[model samples]
Target: MVEIKVKRHEPALIVPENPTKNETLELSDIDDQQGVRVQGAVIMSFKRRSNSIKGEDDPAKVIKEALAKTLHYYYPFAGRVRETGHHRKLVVDCNGEGVLFIEADANVTLNDIQTQIIPPCPLLDDLLFDVPGSTGIIDCPLLLFQVTRLTCGGHILAIRFNHTMCDMLGFMQFLYAMVELSRGAHKPSVMPVWQREVLCARDPPKVTYTHHEYEKGGDKSHEVMNKDESNIIVPGGFLFGPEEIKAIRNHLPSHLQHSYSTFELLCACVWKCRVKALQPDPEDTVQVSMTVSVRENNIILLPSGYYGNSFVSPAITTKAKNLMMSENSLLYALKLVKQSRNRANEEYVRSMMDLMVMEGRPKYKDHLSWMATNLTRKGLEFVDFGWGKPVYSGVPRGTSLVSTFTRFKNGKGQDVIAVVLCLPNEVLLRFQNELGKFVGDFSPLISPTSKL
Candidate 1:
């Protein structure tokens, strides 16, 4: 593999000459008290046919033109990152490569693409990729595009973006635009709205209520509760095949009066197994932290299609040693998870938002270390980059135990959901071993002959 560093000229930091044509999107408002900006990547792969024809439309040229034209539709996206004193927005950076395209051999899979594409991009390497501490960007564009030929005679297009700019829904919109462009469409169905001021945090922001009370200074402040001591990280990340997941789900007895959602069940099982594999003391408390969207929260019902960091809630749950040892059932554990998630009310979300605004942007590390997010169903599959459809897509590393779940369409026209989790290396291996044992005992439940 050839490693090349292409140093392009830095663009002058100038706001676009035309105001009416440009849109302003805010990143600071959506972030939490800790400036630990969220980062994400979208992967889409296509199968190549040996008999396929390469036409007058050069793939690279088509992609460039498509991106340019699509940017005109989502014009706000083309703006470069800008920080002015305390305010920031997407401005025109004529010198920065706001969007980049890298070409690699077809043999690259999603994993290979992530490795090759992220290193060369300075923005990704320095600012976004697996950042250890929180240093949120008011406006940072680290979009990566990799086109690789596959050994199977097809090509793949992978796009990665910082989550601060857009959410799953907005990201899908951007992707759909790219797909439309790839198909030679001059315009997208809907143009992007980049009016950041319109969605700014409320004046004198009133939402300040926290579920968990914080005591300033003292031993309480330094306490690290509910930390996972697992040494093995699951391999193949946290993704589980449809059959494997289904089997695990079916293992849950239906006799329990209260049932749990598939998500709750799966998370509980993973946590339980990981804890067991790690052999943490029975007294060790295990907690699960997951993110929830705040766009619909009553304190701030963001306008429809408003993109930025509108998410706030990070719910967590802990189990005592006695309970974990006596009732080791997955169903019981899932019930606890369900109850914990239910604690995230409008007030909890609003409190975080208020803190973010009041703190005036605390350093990033002060926040990210304690939280783990589950982004399993962030609408990634719906994103079409115009290459038929993506076979698989997601971010595999960086955050602690971050997970993404997607439904895949198989040849038989059946939909199967897959869960991908990224855990520490040792934790992952323990998870795999536990999963192996679970699968050994529960294979029949997941087989085609078994009822779902």
Candidate 2:
């Protein structure tokens, strides 16, 4: 492994070029209250231009200029988040205090980092801006940007935003706006709509459906963040080529053939593999929790540009013994995932809101729970800023959340998927063995032809 070296430049504060007078922006229930516990970040790497290209500004200058101009519209990114209201709801304090911007130079190229799949931590962790506390929502910078230049003329762009401000969809939309401005566009492709009042609870606050994601349990024992090397889980990156996806589809039960989508099938395979890798007691119940978007299925319907957290994670639980049933365990798991996914409708969304209001949202700290999220079809890879689309992009390995990312289009125009997994080091070997059965004789390969 090459010792990756980085040189840090002075950090500058970037405020919106045109500031909005001091004001507070109330967040939607789903956006503000739900995600106040975690931070959302994306790391994207870009290649430097050739010397033959004439009159190109410094990449940092280009990014900073465009960011400044775009911040006028997305000014909330330049703000700080603070708690307000009797129920302790979060609101963005639109004070014109700027966001932190960092510029650094690395001794290695993007390929060097990519070759290692996920760069070593302290090194990987060094690439992004840091926040003080990871759990509670407090007065913190709503946005942070770091641009590290590589010796090979490539650069890594890492952006971190408070999850209370927006969801993945919302975050990508903001990025798209900045990219468009950098490429000399006068206006953004999609305008933002921040009508948090639209998501306010109804007058009566009715609960029409049951939400399985939450339960009545009070246990706050002050669990410290696990940082011990012996306790650290080895992160693994897996690729599911079209061929592998096809094999899994073919293996679906005869009666259920052609009914499962690629995402469902992949989730089923991983959920079961993880259960087996953990080797929990046979009689214990294990659960898979998946997040789904409610923008499309909401009864009242959010606006086209409503950028907020409009998703929910509904969990499905099954006995470890039953989940690993030799004959049709995978099929059975897929069935449960599909059934729980079907609950992302309007009534369910309403019920989730009401339940949170009535029960005062409890932190779901189940040791046996695994979270799976789908970022596959989102237009993250398509975000280009003149240099070209990213060779690779995804989140870092700091959490147990399993995310499926962008499907790049190969020369043959085939969709290639990447699965990012973080598991206990002890269980990784068994997880790989389980995954290999589906991808037979294949290994993790990086295809950088094109990003979606």
Candidate 3:
């Protein structure tokens, strides 16, 4: 067994004044769409400073001290979930569980925490981040802190947050404030903007959509869909190295008639590649859904700090068996994705909003669901809490039916895109092998022009 020094942070002292409860917002009055409820998850990594000289005190104690000081400035965070009569929000619960700390053995890796620890946590398993609890305030689903001793004689702290309450920008701001607190700083230059009223669903709401809209039928909803029973298969989530990502990008043709974004091009290529790798029936139709945010749709210009669950419209493209079997050009497939995205705009959103307002939610159907979103534009890299920059980040679990995409800044300063998908174990291995072949064959074509 690999022995390593380990330390744990004891729960903080709770004041009687604070109590755990749930916050409630009136969905009936505003838009009744279930998507209005926002839930967010973030993972941050921290490295220990090598030159720091502290006495013989336990390292866990030092880290807890740093966290305690940091929590003080963000005192509201220390409280538990509480519910008021109607309004649901985070209330100060003196007796709250506070933050959790687990010191893993040296053999434990970040992947272990993400896959093993995070998915099983009660808070995350319950999916309580969005639901209104008995407390008036929304509970911080599960704020996890995993400290691992790396082989290089340093430590890494991984923090994950639920997205219901905060966006990427808001979470980063809060993180920076925590860092300031750890440093014993009194004030952070950037204060948090707790403007929830602006993002709340409309009053006397014009639309009343429910979870039923995205379900196969009114019987089984998207939220309630059982992954084990559903035909929607997801492969294992894996991270790709720089060279691998470069090769995938190089597979796209440089001489295209219409210009296509990297995401659009790559998404198309990956979708087809995934289908081919799975050896799905050639007659089967594959549908690719891309999420389009309605923040700038002009219908509703959400305030800068608006942190509510906004609209995410899916743009879909379907390809038949013949097309999938006969299509060798990745660019051709990419055009389909590009066309689908360009077509879904303000008018499309308004029409959907009107339909949702008039008819409520729609039902999910049989289709191969795949999506890609750009996180690089969301300022994920800028989120530097006092512990330096995060070494790794991700949303560990939740949606297994659909594959999600995120882009991050790699060490080489290149945009590294990640695709998280789920599929059968055997299919997944085959997919990986196919990806390896595509990358190997494609890398040589782009190496001369590559920036890295």
Tell me each candidate's TM-score.
0.71, 0.89, 0.66
lDDT of 3 at 250: 71
Candidate 2 local lDDT, 131-242, one digit each (tens): 3442245676677788888777778888887787887888888888899888888878888888887776665678786554554556432143234322767766666777
Worst 10 residues of 2 by lDDT: 443-452
Find the 10 residues in a row with the least total lDDT in model 3: 443-452
Error of 2 at 270 (Å): 0.5
lDDT per residue as tens, model 3, 352-385: 5444434444433334545555454555555444
Best by TM-score: 2
Question: lDDT at 414 for candidate 2?
Answer: 68
Name the TM-score of candidate 3: 0.66
Scored by lDDT, model 1 comes in at: 0.48
Shift in Å, residue 234, candidate 1: 8.1
Go through the candidates in order and give each one's C-alpha lDDT. 0.48, 0.70, 0.47
**Tens digit per residue, CA lDDT, model 1, 1-452:** 32323232222221212333533344545532333345566554555433456543334445556666665555555554554445332333323234545554433333333333221121233212232222234445445555555444445555666565676666776767766767766567656655545444566776555423222223242223224433443323433445666677666775642366666666676666656654556665455554555654444565555555555435443544533463566776677667556666666655555555555543332111223344445665554444445554444334343445445454455554444544556655666677666556443121112221
Alpha-carbon deviation at 194 in model 3, angstroms: 4.1
User: Candidate 2: misplaced stretches above 4 Å?
Assistant: 34-36, 50-55, 117-123, 131-136, 219-230, 254-257, 297-300, 401-404, 409-414, 443-452
